[model samples]
Target: MNENKFIQLLKKGDEKAFETLYNEYASKIYGLLRSYLKEDEIEDALQDVYVRIYRGIKGFKQRSKLSTWIYKITVNTAKNYLKKQKKNYLSLDFNLEKNKFTSKENVEKDVFDEIDYEFILNSIEKLPPLDKTIIKLRDIEGLSYYEISKIIDKPVGTVKSRLHYSRKKLQKIIEEDQNEGNG
Candidate 1:
């Protein structure tokens, strides 16, 4: 089942076609979910992403590849979930455990300490949403310019510029921190 046929099936309300599409991309979606939901299991997040995709597929337009559209939905949902978690975390009384935490021999390191793919992912999350999206879609996921342009609904030139800017910004952040540490 190719993208065009899958999209047509989605438009026509075919459950089997939807299942086929979900199965094909579930691993990619699950990887994104597992990264965002570090507290959760891969299978659990996979189920949630599929539920969201099923609910969301009807509103999808065909201008972008079905994969890109699905990825956008997955990322947006993850952001929303994170926001809610942050809000809940903030409401907790951290002061009660401040002394307890400080007394422990904490071993957490700076996320930017590494100079590899995981460090890159950590740094990318620190960037603005549009920039993060541009870098991830174009550089990490390796979507073609045409595909990213369609998914972002931006001109190809704009996508190219944003990607370049995002990479430069990340490089500057990492380099500046390293220089500061060594100095």
Candidate 2:
């Protein structure tokens, strides 16, 4: 079924529609949450996101795409969970040793790759929650600035500025890593 029809069914409280929506979007939502939450926290956050989606579907005015609306709910729900727990949501424990390349040659080859995943993830973890969310939505999720503005309930200009600052901060972090490697 088309998205509009599905959404209409959802708004009407169709059980099958809910199931379909969950099946389609649950993994995407979970993946998005993984960037902002720890493994243990994601399931709880996912439940909360669905609850919000179900309850708020009636009020969804179609100002944005359904996917964007769902993403906004997921992001907000995860943020709320983190806030309640009073912990840094972006701090993920990455075991560098386990991820190490087996050979020195391989390590060197991978290190010089265009983007360093570890460095990028580490830098993202250090960002403030809002900046981190903005960067993730814009760069990682490939959301347009306008879509992001709607999700975060910020003006488009504010969204752009935050994304710009986040990118600059990430660039600085990458440059610092390079400098340290050279030194």
Q: Which parts of model 1 have CA positions greater than 4 angstroms off?
A: 5-20, 30-52, 55-61, 75-115, 180-183
Off by over 4 Å in 2: 92-113
lDDT by residue for model 2 (1-183), tens = 888898899999999999999988887788678767889998889999999999999999997899899998987887887789897746443323223212112322343355556666765676776776776666556688899998889999999778777666766776787788889
lDDT of 1 by residue, 6-65 (tens): 787887879888778776776666555544555444455566667877787778777777
* Model 2: colliding residue pairs: none
Candidate topping TM-score: 2
- Give per-residue lDDT, candidate 1, residue 33: 56
